[model samples]
Target: MTTDLVVNILRHMLEQAMLISAPVLIAAALISFLLSLAQTLTSLQEQTFTTVPRLLLVGTLILIGLPWFARRMVEYTVHMFTDLHRYLG
Candidate 1:
């Protein structure tokens, strides 16, 4: 493959990675923020207070979104494979 094609493929790979990861990352960030706020209000500085809920919520989100995540990954894989000839010269 040419330089431009290599770069384009890498860019697409990264974009797909970010798109796939965005939801879990966002959910974790939002939950951590909210939990931190609550902890600050209550002065409860316990680690588990933040850790458990974040894990639970993130896990739940992953479970609920598993199918969508799989579909996205499958789509990306299929797209890359379908376009494989272009890269193969």
Candidate 2:
């Protein structure tokens, strides 16, 4: 494969990863921030307090959206396989 083709594949992979992960990451960030704010207000600085809920929320979101994420990943994988000959040097 050409350097340009490799770069394009890398870029597309990164874009797909970001697209698949953005929702979970954003949810985690928001949950962490809100938990921190609550901890600040109540003086509860337990690590588990902040961590568990974030994990649960993000996990739940990923579970709920698993199908969509899988579909996107499968599409990318299928596209790559279909273009395998083009990528072969």
Candidate 3:
């Protein structure tokens, strides 16, 4: 295992993680912003108002995106394993 190989592996892992997480994170953030805006407009400051919807939306996004996420993860795992021999030297 060389330094370059380790660095590359780490980089790929992080990239994959970011790619998989970005959609849900982005959706959550957008929903949070919209909820905040609604709260401000309506003077409704209930914590659940923001938290519940965000959670639901995020959950839904994860469920909807699960297949794509799984595929990406599987591909990453396969790629790492397939290239394991190259790093073993």
TM-score of 2: 0.93
In the predicted model 3, the residue pairs found to clash are none
lDDT (tens digit, per residue) of candidate 3 on 26-64: 999999999999999999989999988998999999999
| Model 1: colliding residue pairs | none
Report the lDDT tens digits of candidate 2 across residue range 2-81: 88999999999999999999999998989988999999999987999998999899889989999999999999999999
Query: What lDDT score is found at residue 76 in candidate 1?
Result: 90
> Model 2 segments beyond 4 Å from truth?
none
TM-score of 3: 0.97
- Give the lDDT of residue 44 in candidate 1: 99
TM-score on alpha carbons, each prediction: 0.96, 0.93, 0.97
Quote the lDDT for 67 in model 1.
Answer: 95
> Per-residue CA lDDT of candidate 1, range 1-89, in tens?
79999999999989988988899999999999999999999999999999999999999999999999899989999999999999997
Return the TM-score for candidate 1, rounded to 2 decimals.
0.96
